[model samples]
Target: MTQPSPHPTLTPQFCFSTVALRDFLRISRASIDDSITQNLNALYTPAGQGFDPSSTSVRAPRPQNSRQIAPSSCRAFKDQVLFPSWQVRSDVLNYCASVATSPDPDDPESVLRQVESERDRERVVNERLDPYSARFFPREARTEMLAAVVRQERSVEKIIRARSWGLVGERCGGDFREWEEAMNEWRKAREK
Candidate 1:
C-alpha cells in the first residue's frame, strides 16, 4: 500500500488587511449606535432653543470655523456644521465596516476568529488615523518578527561563546589549529 503524505507542521504567520480592519470598526460602531448618538448629543447639544440647559434663550449654538459657537448664533449653522460632523463620523463607521468584512492576506485563521478584540481594533484604527500618532501597526507585526530573529541569533552566539571548543588558543590552553579543529567537529555533530 502507498504511504500517506506526512502532515505539515503549523507555523505562526502575521496577516492583516485595511478592508478587514475597516469593517471590524464599522460593525462595532453599528452595535453601539445608540450609545454613540447619546454620547454625541450629550457632548454637543443640538441646535435648538432648549438644547442647552445653561442658556436662557431657546436657540442652539452656531458652528464657526469648525468650532461650535455659543447658543446665540443662527440655527442653520447647527444643521450645516454639527449635523455634517455626525455624518462624517458615520462615514468613518462605514469605512470601518468595510475593513472588518475584507479578507485577511496574511492569516486566514485570525480573520475568521476575529482574534483582535473590538476595542483593540478600534484603538488601532484610531491611532493609525491620528495625525500626530506614529504608525505602529500594519507593520509592527513584521518588526516584532524581525526582532525575535535577532534575539534568537544573539542567543545562539552566546551559546557558541560559552562552549569550550569555541575558545581561542589563548583561552583553551591549546594551539589555535587544535581549537579550530575541535570547533569544526562540534558544529558537524550539532548539525546531525
Candidate 2:
C-alpha cells in the first residue's frame, strides 16, 4: 500500500519545535526565531542538498561570533537598554551583557558619556526603586531585556545603562513588568 511512510517520527510541526530544523537550515535558534519566514524558505529550498529536505547537505556554516550566528534582525530583548530619548540600538551591549571572561576589543574606554545633563538626569532619571536585589527573575523577561539592551548605542544615557547593567547583573533587580512601568513613565514624559 502506502509503504508505511518511510519516516514515522517526522511531523509537520515537530520540525519547527525541534532543533533539527535549525541544524538542517544551518542557523541558530535565535536566527530562526528572529525571522521564521526567511529560515523556512532556506529550510524548504536549502542552498545545499539540491532543494531536497530528505537529502543530506553540506555542513551548516559556523558563525565566527554569537551575533553572526543569528541574523542581525534578531532582537535580544534582555540585552536591550532604554534611554532618556528612548532609542533602541540592539548592538551596544553585546559583550557587556555578561561579565567579560576575556579582554574585549569593543569595550568602551569609558562610559562617562552615558550620563545625562544635570537637569535631564534630575527630571527624567528615577532612582533605583527596588532597594533589594531580586532573588529570582523569570527567564523569559531576562532574555527579552538582553535583546532590548543590545540595540542601544554607546552615546546612550548612563542612567539607562545603569539600570540595564543592574538587571543583567541581577543586582538592581526586578522583573520585566517593573521595567515596563519605568520605561513607560520615561517614554510618556519624553513625549510631552
Candidate 3:
C-alpha cells in the first residue's frame, strides 16, 4: 500500500474546466478594456475640456507675412510619418502581446507592471507623433509642446527608469533581448 501523501493539495485530483478558463479570459479582457478607456480619458483635462485652440497659453506667435508650407509629398509623408509611426506602434503592441501571454499571467503584480509599461509605451507614441504635429504647428509651439512633454516625462521618470532585467526573462518568454531592444527604441524616440 502507498504511504499517505505529505502534500495532498499537490495531487492530480484538481480539475480544469473550459468554463473556468473562458470566464478568466473574459475578465482579463474586460480589465484591459477598462484600462484602455481610462488611459484615453486621462488625455483630457479634469473639466472634460480639451486644449483650447483660441488660447494663446501654448500657441506661438505667427509671422504676419509668413506663407503656409505646402503639404508633404505622398512619398515624404509615407516615409517620414506613416511608416515610422506604424513601426513604433507595432513594436509596442508586439511587446505587450508577448508579456501578456507569458507563463506568469496569473500574477497580479506582473499585471500591474504590464499596465504601467503600456502607459510608458503610450507616452513614447505621443513623442513619436511629434513630427506629425510639426506638419501644422509653428516652431515655437513645437518647442513649447516638447517642453511640456519633457515635464510630464520627468514626473514619471522613476517609473520609466526602473528596469528589472531579471524579470524580463520570464516576462519576455525566456529571452530578454527583445524587451531590451524595444525599450531602447522607446528611449531613442524620446531623445529626439
Candidate 4:
C-alpha cells in the first residue's frame, strides 16, 4: 500500500491582492505599536511583573560598565516612561473641584473665570498626553463628571437598597423606619 503518499504535503500560498496588502500593513503597524508599548512597559516594570516608579520600593537599576556587556545583562531597561494616566485624571479633577469650591485670593473676580482657565489647562494636558491616554481619558472628561455619574448611580442603588431594607426589615430584627420614628420621638423629648 502507498499509505496515501505519506499524508498529502501542504504548501503555503501568498496573496498579493490590494486587500491583503492593506491588511498586512495594518497588522504590521499594530504589531509595531504593541511591541513599542511592551518595551515601554518593560522599562517601567520588572520581568513578568508591573512596576511603578512612584511606589516606595524602587528597584536598583543595573550599573552600565560597557555598552555591549551592560545591554546584554540589563535587557529590561526601556526608554519609555509609563506615566500614571488615572492619577493624572484624578488630580486634574481634584484641582477643578478645589478651584470651583475654594475661592482664591488672586482672582476675586468670577469663580467661573478660574474654572475656565483650569479647563484651558485641562485642554493643554489632554493635548500633551499620549494617544492611548487621550483616547481613554480625554482632558475634557473631568473627575467631577465621573463623580456626578457615580452619585447618580448611587442614588439609584440607594432606592434599590431602600426597597431591599423594607423587605428585610422584620427579618433583620427591626425596620429602619421604626428606628427613625424612635429617634424622632427621642429628639422631641430632648427638645421639650
Residue 129 in candidate 3, Cα distance off native in Å? 59
The per-model lDDT (C-alpha) reads 0.36, 0.33, 0.34, 0.33
Error of 3 at 135 (Å): 55
Cα RMSD to the true fold for all candidates: 32.2, 23.7, 28.8, 30.4
Error of 2 at 116 (Å): 54
Which lDDT tens digits does candidate 4 get at residues 13-128? 11112243234333432333224333333333233335555765766665342112123222212111111211222233343344434433443344665576676567633445
lDDT of 3 by residue, 80-110 (tens): 4322433433343333343433344343355
State residue 65's C-alpha deviation in candidate 4, in Å. 81
| Candidate 4, position 4, lDDT | 9
In Å, residue 21's CA in model 4 sits off its true spot by 43
Model 2 quality (TM-score)? 0.16
In what order do the candidates fall by lDDT, top score first? 1, 3, 4, 2
Off by more than 4 A, model 1: 1-109, 112-130, 133-136, 139-147, 150-152, 155-168, 177-181, 186-192
Error of 3 at 114 (Å): 21
Ranked by TM-score from best down, the candidates are 1, 4, 3, 2
Per-residue lDDT value at 105 in model 1: 62
Candidate 1 structure quality by residue, lDDT tens digits, 19-121: 3433433443343332333323343434633455656555667544222323332223223332233334334434333433454366434443354445346
Q: 8 in model 4: Cα distance from truth in Å?
A: 59
